[model samples]
Target: MAVTILGMDIGGTNLRSGFVNDRFELSEFRISSSQAICGEKAPENIAAYIERLMAETGIRPDAISIGFPSTLDKARKRLLSTPNLEGLDDMNMVERLENALHIPVYIDRDVNLLFLCDCHANHLTADVIIGCYVGTGFGNVIAIGGEILVGKNGVAAELGHIPVRGLTLDCPCGNVGCVEMIASGKALKTLQETWYPEEAIGTLFTLHASDEPVRGFINDLALPIATEINILDPDEIILGGGVLQMDGFPKGALEDAIRLHARKPYPEQALRFHYSGEKQENGVIGAAILAFRHMKREKGQPV
Candidate 1:
């Protein structure tokens, strides 16, 4: 029988899980709502969720790996904080889950998981890759030499909260003018409400080629990418998220805008663009990769 690892990706709205072998071939992928938990009930409900998944799959996992949309602590043993998911912040997930399940648990910020996905899926040659995903929110994950740049607090890559133009918009993290507010799904909604009051989101891209307001919103959102590029100068930049998947979206326009704002010396010439397509399986795949890597590390092996 193949040794399998269980993986979970916990987001604000969705919780995704899967099982995979050493090669990252996923099996028994499942997605469920995050509404099953509230405050102190989260650990209990999360345990139930994992048990149900295992029961459904009939797979006894060798280990468990989880990705949280939050900052992990210095030791990677505690959940330090999460700007979006309030209940998970300051929670001792590593200890609680490991004790509850009798399995080793590994957790990291979700953006780092995205970076792992991009590296494996794209077969990127660059040693340093920066992944910027703009969706319901914005997130960043930076990896150098095939390892994550986990800082002292494991909160190194909070790239989306960096202030720009001091523009104040209400952010879920209780901050004003966060990069997410200016560049994320919320930003898209704000722009739609302000400029294209009569248009639907699915059609915004299609209409933008001719509509002034839609065009303006796209350009405005592109500014955040410009800011990130100017600072990080990543060896390779991967852009993925829901907004980029819209029909008739102007891919060339966004790339050109990014290039225009990036530094001329390196980032402009080496910038790489990738759309994650419309598949919802990315989270599951990423989760699987996380588990596979962790299992290898624990076994005194290399990934």
Candidate 2:
């Protein structure tokens, strides 16, 4: 049986929405500024926005799924914290949105949604996998034995916050010197603004591929990734994000730097990796996948 699901990838900057069917085909994808609908009561704003979009598009979905950039509670009901987005802290979006929309609602970390999209798109099946996305911030997720690995508090796979030596940069998540402070897209933007303001950040790799600053930035990008490789030594790593998808980004150099930092003999020698190849609507489609899967499981259908 065919069914339509409404999926959204909500970020600090923008909101992406789309309709996805059981076949995993995405349609009517749209992006809008997140701020336009944000207010003191963000849940209401989100509900209203969905209502308006669905009314306009005339696609009333069987369920709604959202990918939010926030840590979730152990039960995946309440949002623990949302550093980048405002008006979303400590909210039970599942209850609120379901009440407002009168439909089944599902939510998860945005990167986990990205991981689902990566696996579905690439046809990857493995016992352990790590997804490291370098976008506005460092996003990470891990799967062990074919399940998303959530810690006791449901905030596992926060590899971005792993400590770094010889540095004391305060992170929004608190504490000092989280590797994200130096290894993420934010770090790269800082590097560009400091040293090569004349060149666009997107073109930094193309123009200064051999420059030390750019080269070092790439090396830092490898730091957290290599550290994860050292620890988990995942069967496959799905690397993706806006930074890596940019024109002229040096994928080879980044991979080499990762290998350079990886440990010897064990994890380094036989490491396998692949790119996520994510598209603009990848998260949106992944959200739908999550909803559809949940629906199937409730009906005792094989996923």
Candidate 3:
């Protein structure tokens, strides 16, 4: 029998779980809302939800991995902070889940998994890889030496929060004018409300190609992408997220901006893009890969 791996992706609004084999085929996957996990009991509720998912699937796995959209310490054992989800501050996530499940648990920021999936699937090996997800919000992950790069404080690779233009707006992380504030879902929403109160969020990009307001929003979104490109000229830069896949996004315009704003040389010429599907299973499969990697490391094998 093939060994199974269980994986989970914990988002602000939903929790997705699944089982996968060595080939990265997902099965018995499930998704459910996370609205009920509120307040002090939030951690326990998450644990309970995982248990229920495993029971429903009836496939016991030797290991489990979960991804969270939050800042982690270099060890990936605790959630240092989650701006969108307030309940997870200072939580010993790995220990709690491992104790409850009696199985090994692995965890990391969700965007890192996107990078891992892209690298593994593409069969590209590089000493440095940078993955950026551009959607309602920006997510960034960097990998080095075939392992997820964790900074000393575990809060490394937070490229989204880098400030730009000093534009003041409330950030979920309690800052103002963060890069996320200027170029995220919330930023787009604010721009729509202020400049084009009558337009829908989805239609901003559609109108942008012709309308001035729409164009402004697109420019804001591109600024940070350009900044990152100039700073880190990775062997590969993977771009995937809801925003990049949106109907009216000016891919040509964005790339133009990136090239114009980024420094000259091979870094500008070598830029590549990969857009994640709306139904992409990277969340679960990447989580499974994390567990598998951890198991290998525990056995004194290469990860």
lDDT leader:
2
Listed in order, each prediction's TM-score against the native is 0.92, 0.96, 0.93
CA-lDDT, candidates in order: 0.75, 0.88, 0.76
Report each candidate's C-alpha RMSD, comma-separated, in the order given.
2.0, 1.3, 1.8
Candidate order by TM-score, decreasing, is: 2, 3, 1
The best-first sequence of candidates by lDDT reads 2, 3, 1
- Report the C-alpha lDDT of model 1 over 1-303, residue by residue, as the tens digit: 576778787877788888877777787877888666546577777877888777887888887878787778866778877765647878889888888888777787776776677778888757777777877788777777877788876777677787767687777777787777767777888778887789887777776665776666567667777777777777787887777777887878878878877788777887877665455666766767877777678789987
Between candidates 1 and 3, the one scoring higher on lDDT is 3
- At residue 178, candidate 2 shows an lDDT of 91
Judge candidate 1 at residue 54 and give its lDDT. Answer: 79
Candidate 1 global CA lDDT score: 0.75
Candidate 1 shows a clash count of 1
Top TM-score: which candidate number?
A: 2
For residues 1-303, write the lDDT of model 2, one tens digit per residue.
679999999986889999999899888999998886666788999899999988999989999999888999987789888888888888899999999889889999988888899988888888998999998889998988767898999999898898889879888887799998988888888899999888888888788889999888899999999998999988999999888988888999999999999999878888887787747899998899888777888999876
